[model samples]
Structure formats: structure tokens, C-alpha cells
Target: MILYIKYMVSLRCKMMVKEELKKLGLQFVVVDLGFVEILEDITPKQFEELRKNLAQSGLELLDDKKAILIQKIKNVIIELVHYTDEMPKVNYSDYISEKLNYDYTYLSNIFSEVKGITIQQFIINQKIERVKELLLYDELNLTEISYKLNYSSVAHLSNQFKKVTGLSPSFFKKLKEKRNRNLENI
Candidate 1:
């Protein structure tokens, strides 16, 4: 049985779900970002208990098709932005469409309606968050970060970084460094 889950967007979330299933003696064949596959059928009572447990852990079971599609969209973007170091060469819309086997227009419309944001905007937001994480790590310079994330140029990345965050990348990095030093002192 494959069950959809909302807000289960990280590997840690998957681990948590697995732990909960183990606690209940339920065998999960797969526990992914937005869904889970059980090794065998479960009783309705078991299902209800699992549902309540997941909800308490901040993941709600999804029954709506539109919501499930939106979760899939988010899961794909999250995987691309957070997991992959190098952005792919293909257009995001085409990649997403091919991956989901849906018309891009239909997917875009539903994503906007359900998420209150365009898919492009969501991509940008996730990219910016990824940039922040990379900056915090202090492992890669801005030029390398821009190239890894597939920006046209370092200037394009700086422009978008400033536009989204209202601060230059240099300043953001410095701020993180200062905050880390203060934590170390503490």
C-alpha cells in the first residue's frame, strides 16, 4: 500500500516515518519524501493509528490527488536543490514534465492554484535556500556556487541573490561567519 504524506520533505522526515512504522510493527517497503509503500496490507485500525501518529509528527496523510501532485512537485524540486550539487542542463519545466508524465501547463496551473506560488518562483526560492546553505558551509566560493547551481554568470547569481535576500552574497557570508564565531565563543 502506497500512502501519500504531506510535508515529509527531507531524509530526516523519512527516517522519522520509518521509526514510527517500526514502533508499530508495520513493515514499510519504502519511505520517501511524500509517500510510503507498505510491505503488506494493513488493517484500517492500524492505518488510523499510523495516520494519527504521522500527524502528530507534523506530516499529514494526503488523500487529495491535487495535493499529492503538489507534494511530488515539491519533492522533485527539493531533491534537485538540496541533494544535487550540479544543476541539470535541461529546462526545469521540461524535466519536471517528463518526470511526472504530465503536461507542463496542467502541472503549472495546479501548482499555482494549490501552492499560491508559481513553479518558477518555488524553484527560485529553493535555489536561494540552497545558496544560503552553501554559504553557511563556507566550503565553496561565490563563483563556484554560481556555476554549480547553473547560473549564467556570477553577476546573474549576485543579482538574484540580492533581489531575493536584499543583501549581497559577501555580506551574507560575513554575517554567517560572525554568527558562527559568536556561537563558538559561547
Candidate 2:
């Protein structure tokens, strides 16, 4: 039996779900980002108990088909942006459509209707967040970060970063440094 779950984005979330399944005495074949496959069918009582337990932890057992598809879309984007070592060379629309096995137009319409933001905007936001993380790490230079994130050029990356954050990348890094310095003095 396959069960879909909402808000199961991170590795920690997967672990929590696995633990919950174990506690419920349910054997799962796989506990993935947005779904789990169980070795045996779950009884109604077991399903209710599992749902209640997951709800307590801010996770949800999803049954709605549209909701499930939306969660799948989110999981794909999250995995691509936050988990992958390298971004794909193809256009994001193609990549997303290929990954989800659905027409891009259909997926885009559904995601926009449900999320209130276009997938492109979501991708940009996620990219900006990744940029912030890299900046905070103090390891990669602007050029390196741009290339790593598959930006066309440093200027493009900088423009998008400024547009999203209202602060230039260098200034953002400076703010982090200043905060760290102040913390050390305390």
C-alpha cells in the first residue's frame, strides 16, 4: 500500500515518519520524500492512528489527488534545489515536466492555483535561499557560487539576488561578518 504524506520534506522528517511507522507496528518498504510504501495493507484503525500521530508532528496523511500531485511537485523542486549536487543542464520547465511525467502547462496551472505563486518564482526563491546559505558558509566566491548554481553570469546572479533580497550579495556577506564579530566580543 502506498500512502502520501504532506510536509515531509527533510531527512529529519523522513526519520520521524519511519519512527512513527515503527511505533504503529506498520512495516514500510520505503519512506520517501512525499510518500511511503508499506509491506502490507493498512487497516482503517491503523490508518487513523497513523494520521493522528503524524498530525501531532505537523505532518499530514494526504488522500486528495490534487493535493498529492501538488506535494509531489513540491518534493521534486525541493529535492532538485536543496539536495542535488548539480542542477540539470536542460531548461527547468523541461526538467520539471520530465521529472513529474506531466505536461508543464497542466502542472504549472495546478501549482499556481494551489500555491499562489508560479513554479518559476518558487524556483527563484529557492535559488536565492541557496545563495544565502552559500554566502553564510563563507566558502564560495560570488563567481563560483553563480556557476555552481548554474547562473549564466555573475551579473545575472547578482541582479536576481538584489531583486529578491533588496541587498547586494557583498553587503549581505558583510552583515554576516559584522554580526559574527559582535558575537565574538560578547
Candidate 3:
């Protein structure tokens, strides 16, 4: 059986799920960002117990089909912004539509309706958050950060960063308490 989960965005989350499944005496064939596949079907009682354990850790077991679709979208965006080693050659709209097998217009409408923000806004937010991370690492300069994130220029990146965060990239980098929230929270 396949189970979709919320807030399963990090390696730590994956480990927690594995450990919990072990404690519950369930064997999972695979566990990925937002879903898990188990070798055996779980009974209602077992499912409830697993849900309770997951909830205690600030996670939720997704049962609704629409909710699962949303989670999948979140996972895809998270993977792109967080795990991808290089910028995509094509636009994110085309990439997302091809990857998810959904029309871009439909997906954009649903995402905006549910998220209270446009998908483009979400992408910008995520990209800004990533720039913050790269800045903190101190390994890449502003131009490199811009290039890595597919920004047209350093000035453009700085402008957008200021617009979203109310501070310029340099100012944000100098702050001692720079923080990057998880994609799900954003």
C-alpha cells in the first residue's frame, strides 16, 4: 500500500518515518519525500496508530487524493529548489507540467487557490531562501548565487531579494541570525 505524508521534506524526516515503521512492526518497500510504499497492507488499527505517532512529530498522514496531489507538488518544488545541483535549462512552468503530467494552467490555478499565493511567488520565495543559504555558506559571491539560481543578473536578484525580504542581499548576509525556513512552512 502507498501512503502519502506531510512535512516529510528532510533526511531527518525520512529517518523518523523508517524508525517509526520499525517500531510499528511494519515493513516499507520504499520511503521518499512525501510518500511511502509498504510491502504489506496495514489494518485500520495499525494505520491509526501510525497516524498518531506521526502527528506527535508534527507530521500528518495524507488520505485525500487532492491533498496527496498538493503534497506531490510540494515535493517536486522542494526537490528542484533544494536538491537540484544545477539550474534547469527550460522554464519551471514547462518543466513542472511535463514532470507532473498536468496542464500548467490547471496546476497554477489550483496551487494559487489553495496556497493564497501564485506558484511564481512561491518559486521566487523558495529561490530567495536558497540564495540566503548560499550566502551564509560564504562559498559563493552574489554573481555566482544569481547564476546558480538562474537570475538574469546580480542586480535583479538583489532587487527581488529586497522586495521579498525587505532587505538587500548584502544586508541579509551580514545579519548574524540568518534563517531559512523549510519549503513546507513557507
Candidate 4:
């Protein structure tokens, strides 16, 4: 049995889902981002119980095909920005189209209808979030972050960061440093 789950975006979420499945005594073949495969088929009663159990943890079981596809698109973008080490050589549209096996036009239309934003916008948002995360960690310099994220140049990265966040990357890094120092002083 395969289950499509919504809001399973992080490793922590995967762990929580796994724990819930174990508590329900379900045997899972895999617990991946936004999907779980079970070794055995579950009864509707068992499915309902699992659904309710997951809901308690802010996860949702997706039965609608459209919803499942939307979640998949989100997951793929999330993985690309936050998890993958190497960015694809091709552009995002080509990469996403290839990865999902859907024509870019259809995917774009459905995604915009459901998400109220273009896929490019979503990718930029996810990239900005990743930049924020990297800035917070303070392990990578602006140059390194820009390179890691496949931005053409540091100026471009800074421009996008300022555009999306209303703050320059250096300013953001300083603010994070200030917060960390304040915590340490406490």
C-alpha cells in the first residue's frame, strides 16, 4: 500500500510519521518525503486510524490525485533547494519537467492554479529560505552560498535576497550574529 502525505517536508517530519506508523503497528517499506509505502495492505479502518493519527501531528493523508501531484511538486522543489548537493545543469523548468514526467505547460498551469504562484516564484522562495538557513548557520560565506545555490554571482544572490527579504545578506547575517550573541550573554 502506498500513502501520499502532505506537509512531510523535513527529516523531523519523516521521523514523526515513522513513529506514528510504528505505533499503529503498520509495516512500512519506505517512509520518504511525502510518500510512504507499506509492506502490507491496510484495511480502511486501519487507514482511517492512521489518517487520524497523522492528522494529530499536523500531517495530512492525500487521496486526491491533484493534491498528491501538488505535494509532489512541492517536495521536489524542497529537495532541490534544501537537500540536494548538486544543482541540475539544466534550468528548473526542464529539470522539473524531466523529473516529474509532465509537460512544463500542464505542470505550470496546475501548480499556479493550486498554489497561487508560479513554479519559478516557488523555487525562488525556497531558494531564499535556503539562503536564510545557510546565513543563519554562518558556516558559508556569501560567495560560497551563492556558488552552492548555483546563483551566477554573489551580486545576483544579494539582489534576490534583498528583494525577497527586504534585507541584504550581510545585514541578515549580522542580525543572526546579534541574536546568537544575545543568547550567549543570557
Candidate 5:
């Protein structure tokens, strides 16, 4: 059985889900960001118990089909932004459509309606966050970060970063205050 989980954004979330499943004596074939595949059919009692426990940790078991699809989309974007170090050569719309097996128009409309933000905006936001992360590491220069994020040039990246963050990349890098957006809000 496959189960969709809400708010499972980070790698820590995957580990927590695995640990929770083990504690509940449920055997899962795999536990991922938005879904888990279990070895056995779950009883209602087990489901309720697991659901309650997950709720305590700011996670919810998702049952709605639309919500599940949205979560899956979010999972893909999160994986791309946080895990992959390289920018995709293809357009994000086509990449997402191919990955999700849905029309790009439908996906974009649904995502915007549900999340109140365009997919492009979400990608840009994630890219900015990644730039911040890379900057904080202090190992890579602006040019390197731009290349890694697939920006056409450092100037383009700086412009977008400033537009979204209201600070130049260098200024933001030096401020030292941590700013992060909520995953669901993104």
C-alpha cells in the first residue's frame, strides 16, 4: 500500500517517517518525501494510531487525490532544488511534465490555484534559497553559484536575487541573519 504524507519536505522528514513506521511495527518497502510503500495492508486501528503520531510531528497522512498530486509535485521540486547540484538543460515546465506524466498547463494551473503561486515563482524562490545556502558555505564565488543554478550570467542571478530578496547577493551573504520560507508557503 502506498501512503501520501503532508509536510514531508526534508531528508530529516524521511528518516522520521521510517523511524515512526518501525516504532509502529509497520513494515515499509520504502519511505520517501511524499509517499511511503508498505509491505502489508494497514488496519484502521493501525492507520489511526500512525496518523495521530504523525500529526504530533507536524505531518499528516494525505488521502485526497488532488492533494496527493500536489504533494508529489512539491516533492519533485524539493528534490531538484535541494539534492541536485546542477541546473536542468531543459525548460522546467517540460521537465516537470515529463516527470509527472501530466500536461504542463494543467499542472501549472492546479499548482497556482492550490498554492497561490506560479511554478516558475516557486522554482525561482528555491533557486534563491539555494544561492543563499551556497553563499553561506563561502566556498563558491558568485559566478560559480550562477553556473550551478543555471543562470545565464552572474548579473541575471544578482538581479533576480535582489528582486526577490531585496538585497544584493554580496550584501545578503554578509548579513548573517537566517531567513527561510515555510515549505508549504513556497
Candidate 6:
């Protein structure tokens, strides 16, 4: 039996879900970001117990098809932006469509309707967050960060970063450096 889980994004969440499944004596074949495949069918009592337990931890057991699809979409984007070392070479729409086995238009419409943001916007937002993370790490220069994030040029990255954050990338980095210096002095 396959069960979809909402808000199971991080490795820590995965661990929690695994522990929950073990506690319920539910043997799982796969426990991924958004879904789990168990070796045996879950009973109604088990399902309800699992749902209540997950809810206490701010996670949800999803049953609605549209909600499951949306969670799947989110999981894909989260995995891509936060986990992967490199972005895919193909267009984001094509990548998402292929990954979800759904038409791009359909996915985009549903995602926008449910999330109140277009998929492109979501991708850009995620990219900007990733840029912030890279900047804070201070291990990569702007040029390197641009190339790593697959921006066409540093100027383009700077423009987008400024647009999203209202602060230039260098300024954002400076803020992090200042914070570190203050902490060190403390």
C-alpha cells in the first residue's frame, strides 16, 4: 500500500516517518519525501493511529488525489533545489512534467491554483533561497554561484537576486560576514 505524506521534506522528517512506521509495526518497502510504500495493507485503525501520530508532529497523511499530486510536485522541487548538487539541464517545466508523468500545463495550473504561485515563480523563489544559502556558506564567489545555479551570467543572477531579496548578492554576503564578526567578538 502506498501512502502520501505532506510536509515530509527533510531527512529528519524521513527518519521520523520511518520510526513512526516501525512503532506501528508497518513494514515499508520505501519511505520517500512525499510517499511511502508498505509491504502490507494498513488497517483502518492503523491508518487512523498513524494519521494522528503524524499530525502531532505537524505532518499529514494525505488521501486527496490533488493534494497528493501537489505534495509530489513540492517534493520534486524541494529535492531539486535543496538536495541536488546541480540543477537539471532541461527546462524546469519539462523536468517536472517528466518526473511527475503529467502534462506541464496541467501541473502548472494545479500548482498555481493550490499554491497561489506559478511553478516558474516557485522555481525562481527556490533558486533565490539556494543563492542565499550559498552566499552564507561563503565558499563560492558570485561567478561560481551563478554557474552552479545555472544562471546565464552573473549580472542575470545579481538582477534576480536583487529583485527577489531587495538586496544585492554582495550586500547579502556582507550581512552574513558582519553577523559572524559580531558573534566572534561576543
Question: On residues 1-186, what C-alpha lDDT tens digit does candidate 2 reach at each position?
Answer: 999999998889899999999999999999999999999999999999999999999999998999999998888888888889899999999998999899999999999999999999999998999999999999999999998899999999999999999999999999999999999999
Give the count of colliding residue pairs in each prediction. Answer: 0, 0, 0, 0, 0, 0
TM-score of each: 0.94, 0.94, 0.91, 0.95, 0.90, 0.95
Q: Candidate 4: TM-score? A: 0.95
* Ordered list by TM-score, greatest first: 4, 6, 2, 1, 3, 5
RMSD of 5: 5.9
Which of the two, 4 or 5, has more TM-score? 4
Task: After the best TM-score superposition of candidate 4, give how far the Cα of residue 23 lies from its true spot, in angstroms.
Answer: 2.4
In model 4, which regions exceed 4 Å deviation? none
Q: Itemize residue pairs with steric clashes in candidate 6.
A: none
Q: How close is each model in CA RMSD to the real structure?
A: 1.4, 1.3, 5.6, 1.1, 5.9, 1.2
- CA shift of 156, model 1, Å: 1.3
Quote model 1's TM-score: 0.94
Q: List, residue by residue over 1-186, the lDDT tens digit for candidate 3.
A: 999999999999999999999998999999999999999999999899999999999899999877887788878888898889887989999988888999989888888877788878888998998998898888999999899888999999999999999999888876734344444356
TM-score of 5: 0.90
Candidate 6 structure, TM-score to reference: 0.95
Runs with alpha carbons beyond 4 Å of true place in candidate 3: 177-186
Better of 2 and 5 by lDDT: 2
**Model 1, span 1-186: residue lDDT tens:** 888899998888999999988988989888987889998887888888888999998999887899989999988888888888678899999989988999999999999998899999999888889889999988999999999999999899899989999999999999988988999999
- Worst ten in a row by lDDT for model 6: 78-87
Worst-scoring 10-residue span by lDDT in model 2? 74-83
lDDT of 4: 0.93
What lDDT does candidate 2 reach at residue 80? 88
